[model samples]
Target chain A: MKSIITEPMIPKPFRIHRKLKETHDTYTIELESTNGADGFPFSAGQFNMLYIFGVGEVPISISSDPSMPKMLKHTARSVGTVTKALLNLRRGDILGVRGPFGSHWPVEEAVGNDVVIVAGGIGLAPMRPVLYSFISHRDKYGKIILLYGARTPEDLLYKKELELWRGRFDLEVKVIVDSASGNWRGNVGVVTTLIPRIQFDPLHTVAMICGPEVMMRYTLKELQNCGIKNENIFVSMERNMKCGICLCGHCQFGPKFVCKDGPVFCYDHIKELFGKREI
Target chain B: MNIAILECDHLQILLDVLRKRGYQVIGPTLGEGAIVYSDLNSTANLPIGWTDEQDGGTYRLKKRNDKALFGYTVGPHSWKKYLLPSELRLWKIKRNGVSFQIVTENEATRKFAFVGVRSCDIHAISVQDKVFMNGQYIDQHYTSQRKDTFIVAVNCGKAGGTCFCVSMNTGPKATFGFDLAMTEIIEGKNHYFLVETGTELGAEIFREIPHKQANEKEKCAADDILRKTAEQMGRSMDTSNIKDLFYRNHEHPRWNNVAERCLTCANCTMVCPTCFCTTVEDVTDLMSEHAERWRKLDSCFTMDFSYIHGGSVRASTKSRYRHWITHKLATWIDQFGTSGCVGCGRCITWCPVAIDITEEVHAIRESETVIGKQKTIVKEDIHANTGTLSGRTSFFKRP
Candidate 1:
């Protein structure tokens, strides 16, 4: 029983310090470990298995800057039962948190190279940390570009942050929506359509993409068409995950366990399995 | 390092030795309509004189002229039933006033001494060891059960209609992954079991049983039994570069042909020893004060196995069938460093429609269309030619 007590599946209690409504269906919650322990430092693109007391658990990416490990944050959509419960959580509410699991974006590897971050819908949440890391050390990388897309204007996450990032002269930000509504006056097309607007040195560019599988495929094709080698591209994948530590077999995508082997993978490593319709 | 011959009737002594040591002996028993693995208190429970005739989608127990203690190759149920149990309680959550408290399930306590494990099944257990123990996160429940298990492997004296361990290079003789290995030999009116110890635990138990040193003649009989079993294999698969075969043939039309026959019943996955996919089920009491999470066996053939946020990645029967066979034969090596299938042929026998994996792989291997398609795949992999594919890449300005 003592061995079971210390099992990896047993999540530690965390208090929701603050909860910000990101959109109609999504919320960004800041968490502080209840035990006051030195929290595990996580890298950009890693995820946490957030558990609602009596509901269920789901893998949500750490949307906050990785450098500030003490202030843990996650952005989740109210799509499933567990996530809906998470979105309803009030400040000081106790919840279970496990992980900071899976592979992270190669921010260190792209230090001297031009970094292109592409995301779609809520997919931008996982890419938020990468943008933070790049901007924090803006002098280390070359051209820093972010191309984001969503279904509509209302569906966009971190709208204020996008405006703040757009104000920065050092960063190149392009935002697009599939079906624009109201008095929206911006790029009204897929994210790939904005790729040509940003100038990057193809041979020295490192592209990191996270989105729907179809969007990821098109982004990879666009990146490769710009003379970006497959080895220089990375994509984050998603599957139904139970144990974030790779014990449960639900998150397998071919040979890779999305929870462990990647939420982030080099394009060449998974290119064969990528765009595979039946896989 | 001792070989001994125990008389047929003295098989009870072997069970008695294990029972005295507080090990609940589990072995094959004739149950309902077929031979299944279950607990055995005495030799009476053993499938004595009962030899199973097995084929794709067929199984029958027939009484043999000689009363052989271990004549069957393997039953539908495997040693995985004890190690990787179908239903396992992960944890229980109790309402602690306003907050919830988690209650972890205790580790397995029963010590198991498996009586009639086969070579292929032993390999299957080892394969699962790689999954449950060797992984980054250890399954404490599985480790506890596996650590307490004492294996008594039985060398196959005959092969079933679907048996293909010889092709997989796994069986017919119990070579490894066993505490004790035995070969049952019955000649004329005399019958005895030649036993050999594989571990110190097996040697300790063998010393307590009534047995004598086996001579050269008796050793020859044991070797002859295994030799005949190997030669009489019912099926053979060419495993040369099998990983590449499935990797290249994912789009082969043979999958569609097999999908027409596959019922998607998941019977094959349920019986397969190495298929370790599982899903978590959460249950709550009516009062909602107590809730528990149970891990249950899940099959790749299920419609929701590969489900994400939207829907299942593998929705069609063709994709499901291809995923199962290809994962077992190809991608498994990349994941676990070995083939997932031990070639027990249980999947072939237990399948309702008798869709043989060997036959499916053969059709893919023999397809002329796949050979032609491979050339196109090679060409498509060249980045320059596929630059304009789908017209989406053209949006990126060439620099």
Candidate 2:
């Protein structure tokens, strides 16, 4: 028997270029190839398998700008062991990175149409790149709007970037917090309440949403109520993924392998399965 | 050269020939009431004149009137155990200063000769080849084990109660993917093996077996036995546009009915030859100085199989059962360009509750036949009375 060595599961070494805390529990870590290799290119909603030595791996979305291919950025919450190990890393620390996998948000398909960005809490991380693409190419898309909701003021991510994006008159950004604590003056309700305050031509709008399943469900209903066609709405799905490729069968959502077929799927394609429980 | 005939008592010569070539010959042996595949050095280990009666949730061994070897359809054991093993170490990682270096295990060099392999199992192995070998990333372990193995396929002379390879287009006879193909011929007082070489290695091995040319009458008897086996298939599934059948009926009510009966024991996936899902775990000693990542067979029925950070995706047995059946008959064709099930019937016979996949498909198709009239009634009842939360509460109430 001839043994052929294959290491598709092995991760490549990537060094931390910088680390910045987004929220109290979330951190945005910038990474680059340790050997000065070419940077891993990825789309907005696609994810990378971040591997922590002696720990394990987790799928984190590439939250960095797609145009700048030299540096890779991932926003991770200290939710589990692997994410905790990643959060503990200092500058120049080495970790393994595999992929740039799954389907991306249809940013190109949304061109020439008004795009509605709705995100909840840490769910905003995957949508941050899509906002970057729309802001950089300001004229390609029509009235860009973002409606972000958080559990508390402290949970809001990319604070400085949100402030800078708000300064622009071309795009509209609305922020809401679930409950008030210290001089909280914004809207005090779920993300679905903020959808009515924003206005866009729903007929020509492409809505992209990412959040908890229940939150996404309520937000989807609100978007459809605003005359947004089911075909125009896209939602990012979450499932346990072992292999970013379609081999492991862990991330299967019906006929689709969320790791391969999609993390971002159009509403029409998955309308039958969106609110499905235990599936 | 031409087809050869081996007398019933001269089967020991072939075992000796394989052993002389440094091959560990494996064949069916009577063990603890069941015929299982194990090491066979002589014909005494063979389950001669023994046949098995199999049905959904039932199996029994019975002595046959004719003294013919390899008369049974298939046992609980498939050829997958020899190829894609249950557990294997993917790689060993040792902490080297700051970074770790991974050292892959050396390939297993033990050459194997698997005798009495059924045709459905050979097709099942080929289906796995499409998954492990023909894919972009080849499974190194499966590749090495497959390359060194020799197949001696035995054409079925009798079909079990659960045999259904004829419907899946796999076979009751060995069509290809074998080094040597044999048919057990029992006519009156004569019992012999019609051995046909499928490859150069098989031809060379046949030359050393001291066999004589099979005449026309012997060849006719061999073909006649396979013909009878095909006619006696106990179960069959309609594969005509089977992929679309499951796709259109993903939310059919039959899934809930089956889920009520399912225990989620995962016996079906364990016995299925084509269900190749797996998971990896990192194990270390108490001191935690060294860790080894081992890959083991996993079943889709387990809640941990679909678990992500927050919770399991397929938390309900209905969803897991739906995923298993749909993936086997429907979506598997989209992913691998072939059906995941080879209709081996291991799933049917081994399932504790006797949940037959063929029966499930028939139920779905029949439900769909009357779906136009029953659509509004089923939809309203599902939403008004049996919503997911209420339905889940009732599903778990089952004892």
Candidate 3:
């Protein structure tokens, strides 16, 4: 119950509204501001610096709808130290938040063309807001295709939402698992295998991909093979980020600060560095 | 806007005037056998008649035959230790029952009067200004310290062995960004400082100290000193096509060559005036009631600089060196619209194994085994022996 400070580095506290178990390793938590503030307004691909009370901070993308700003939802797998500490939090726990930072998904660029979204593993979380935007403005685009892949069936995030997206008539969702068992009745191949099955205008397609750097690297070739120009391909890149601004110098991928110049960059802009080893 | 000559006899009046104006006077003084920037309430604290010899992996202090206050090139420290600071407590977290409140550091600040800032370091400060002040988000701490600082920039009378300010187009002469720019002239019988006022406050302070209007003789003496310093440059690099040279040659053999000698000790970043990367440390009390967010200066050479879930992206020394050099020389232009290096040569002189950036660039430029252009990389001395682009305007100005 104190006056809020507006220094960019400081974090604003958000109370945990709810937490849902997405998978054995991944969980999606909903947060609401405890400090009598309005909704968090941010673009689809923007991320936030979530701070635990005594632990460190982690950069997680907002996975909820931009329209629903009061409730901020983040889907995270317990991968590192900060994420591991975040997974143990319960309801009513206060979390420090900064941003909705970085560049958003190129939803505007994809309008009036066929939109293809490719996600690998937990990469789908960053693109969830893009999906919300696309579904609302579904009439503005031609074909909408979502191609997602994971380690196995159990590792897939947002299974219920994936099913809902698949049931929509205007949208086409295709998922592939590297390998699966126990009545897993779906395609068992890499996500690139699904690129040939979808039907979209190659010249007019605007593809947005998010995933592991290796997966996105391979997807770039697959998309290019399908006659998608490098200019029309947009990929969300992930690097270790701190400060959520350009100051930390941690998230630099070549000339671009992944936190500032982009978390999302057009393929033409970063094509030179995309496949370069150890870059 | 007026220039004056302060006789060496009345130099203490300048420090006294600054102290009376409620400004902490920080200038070079002999500390641990090296000229260090520290508090000076009296003129006796100044490093009089002292000069330093610096080269790759070596430094030593020597005494000058004549008396001159600003006789040395830059040392291992910069004003950044005061501006952004080495360790800064950003905010304090206090746990109060179920709810805790955050308290940001908002204390009142005292003004600073930096007495002996060099031209290359002046450019270093300005480069940092572009990164911290002119960016999308302004750093409040850096801005607060920088805005009120009274800079007394000095034109270097001589160049260090590793100095390349002339090649970087940053110095030999202080161009802009200081409140006052001075030059030392230790002629046979007369020892005086030719000081030029660069701002209103600088003129006012110069007026308080005892000085006479600088005539053409004093002006020529100052200019001639800077002219000789420019000619005596120990190193130069071809910055004409530096961006392309670094951006295109990521896999150059010179990087692997430098990695073999580099210890990854991070001495270069520690001494670099323009390196502003920072990391935060969270310390909590035993009872877990109080936590403080402390930000410390970090270097790209550290293994944790690129740490992610599994490991670091730049795990090897080769990649870290590649990131440091490329970011400073090339990528900084893309991110900040300007190059990050000031050519002060701290990275060269402080490097334990003496890995020189100018030499590395020269080596990479010497053997043109570049990416993409798998076309023959003709080895040419195109950029060799160059800094001869005289009579041209300075390419790197303080943004």
Model 1 earns a TM-score of: 0.94
Segments of candidate 3 deviating more than 4 angstroms: A1-6, B369-399
Once model 1 is optimally superposed onto the true structure by TM-score, how far is the C-alpha of residue B52 displaced, in angstroms?
1.1
For candidate 2, the docking band is acceptable
Model 2 per-residue lDDT tens digits across residues B229-299: 89998898988899888877767677888899999999999889988888877766565455677778899
- For all candidates, the clash counts are 0, 0, 0
The Cα RMSD in angstroms, rounded to one decimal, for candidate 3 relative to the true structure is: 6.1
List per-prediction Cα lDDT, in the order shown: 0.87, 0.85, 0.87
Tens digits of lDDT, candidate 3, B1-399 = 688998988878988888899889999999977888899888788888889999999889999988778788988888887887889998998877656789999878768999889988898899899888877777888888888899988899999999999999999899898888888888899988888889898888888887889899889989899999999888898898889888878886667777888899999998998888998888888998988899999999999888887688999999999999998999888888877888899899889888899888777775663321222222222435333324323221211
DockQ of 2: 0.30
**lDDT (C-alpha) at residue B274 in model 3:** 86
True contacts kept of each: 0.52, 0.36, 0.52
How would you class the docking of model 3? Answer: acceptable
TM-score of chain B of 2: 0.91
> How big an interface RMSD has model 1?
4.5
1 versus 2: better TM-score goes to: 1
Scored by lDDT, model 2 comes in at 0.85
Distance (Å) between predicted and true CA of A209, model 2?
2.4
